[model samples]
Target: MGVHSVNWEPFLTCAVTGAGDTLSKHPDLPVTPEQIATAAIEAAEAGAAIVHIHVREPATGKGCREVAYYREVVERIRDSGVEVLINLTTGMGGDVVVGDRGGEDTPAPGSDFVGAMERLVHVEQLRPDLCSLDCGSLNFDDDRLVYVMPPAYLRPSAARIRELGVKPEMEVFDLGHVAFASRLVAEGLVEPPALFQLCLGISYGAPSTPAAMVAMRDHLPEGAVWSAFGLGRMEMPMVAQAMLLGGNLRVGLEDNLWLRRGVLASNADLVRRAKAIVEDLGGRLASPKEAADRLGLPPA
Candidate 1:
């Protein structure tokens, strides 16, 4: 396969609702199952071939791992006949918050660490087209908040995802994380044509820059399909950059919450803007079926 060949056709992924603390920040963030499904469908209609989903607690709007929420969201999307691929988030349930400085043994109130099996419950039950497997852990935003994904945890999670006949989208936050994912592929834990999402511009991780993105892209294993995204203002810029680098692009309220300064964005708006940028640059947007074929995914 010509890994570095220019990708004149790009696929867009709209991350409908991320498992972040953005409910209060964005007034229109999709919290309920119905709302989330609507947003996903709208995004697909606006040129998103895939929708990366993360369910939140309907009442409190906090991120949760409730299988019912995922079921409802998936059912609505599938029932709508939108022809979009589903990529569920298995990266939740691994958050760890450090408690008082002196009380190292005690985890903070928000910490919710669980085994791999618990994280995969929705993926196993719903059997989405793809599920994310975070490659490694790091301090999410600051010293107090950390996201944990050790190799021991990832191996079993990857194995289970494979057994379920679902594709695992390895989320790599840094160079080391990419190396670890390569190890998983080398060990045959991750299936061939490994998929990776290069996550950049988050706190304490790789910066969102052209140089950094190219570095990560260069490190990807041969025949591996990769995509990259940056948070906040870097979102649209990275969309073009990732496509120019011969990879796909992602956008939504999950990574960014604004269409412009002082303007809030819905998932559909983000996807539309990204679509416009992709097309304006002489790149064709891939439909759901086209994206699936390129990624070696079965039709939706």
Candidate 2:
């Protein structure tokens, strides 16, 4: 892979809430569509050009693939007239857990596996400015659990995402994931100037280190627009590393719960910190209009 230069003018993507079980860890973690929408607005007001979103089961706080929840969140954000670009997640419905016993029951519970088209249902309906396309799957946080997305599923999903006229932000967890995403782009399933998100520091994946970030960035397709994020304490450090490496960066409660050692952070708080870091480093934050034009999305 060739060395890719740094992005002097970078965009910030605040992932308000992810599918993880961070509710108990952070008291203010957004659960319902209303709260999630509110968090997105706050992040936007705090200088995030894009908001990466994942809906949860309102009553349980666990991530869900319900279109109603997504519709509510999208409607709320649009109604609020936030200038930030919306990037809905299609990373749900791919989690799988295995049982000790074999056969049909061996699949075990906590598995939300579904076909490719089923995962993109929400993206097709709302047709937001951007929707994430997890390029590959890997063993989740636990041993028995795995996120499954083979080429069979991704190819069709990418094709459908292209058809919807919504830009696909290819989320890559590791090096292999980046290679696979590049293949999709090579095959024309994804359009030019492909957007990528390097997810690091998750259990069983790439660590949140300069080497890992650079390796992933180096391997990205030529001329690809990309960003990087690390989980937990590494979140803030990765913010600097990503920018230094010439890429945009993401920071939010979804990837981290604390702004410091003990204090919890709101989505806006994280965005504010990231903005400050970018400015201090002599890098400018791109506005939503600037980001949209660079990423080839229609104006909001």
lDDT of 1 by residue, 86-166 (tens): 999998889988877647664788889999899999999999999999999999976688899988898888889999999
Ten-residue region with minimum lDDT total, candidate 2: 1-10
Kindly list the per-residue Cα lDDT of model 2 for residues 208-232, writing each as its tens digit: 9999998899898888988999999
Off by over 4 Å in 2: 1-4
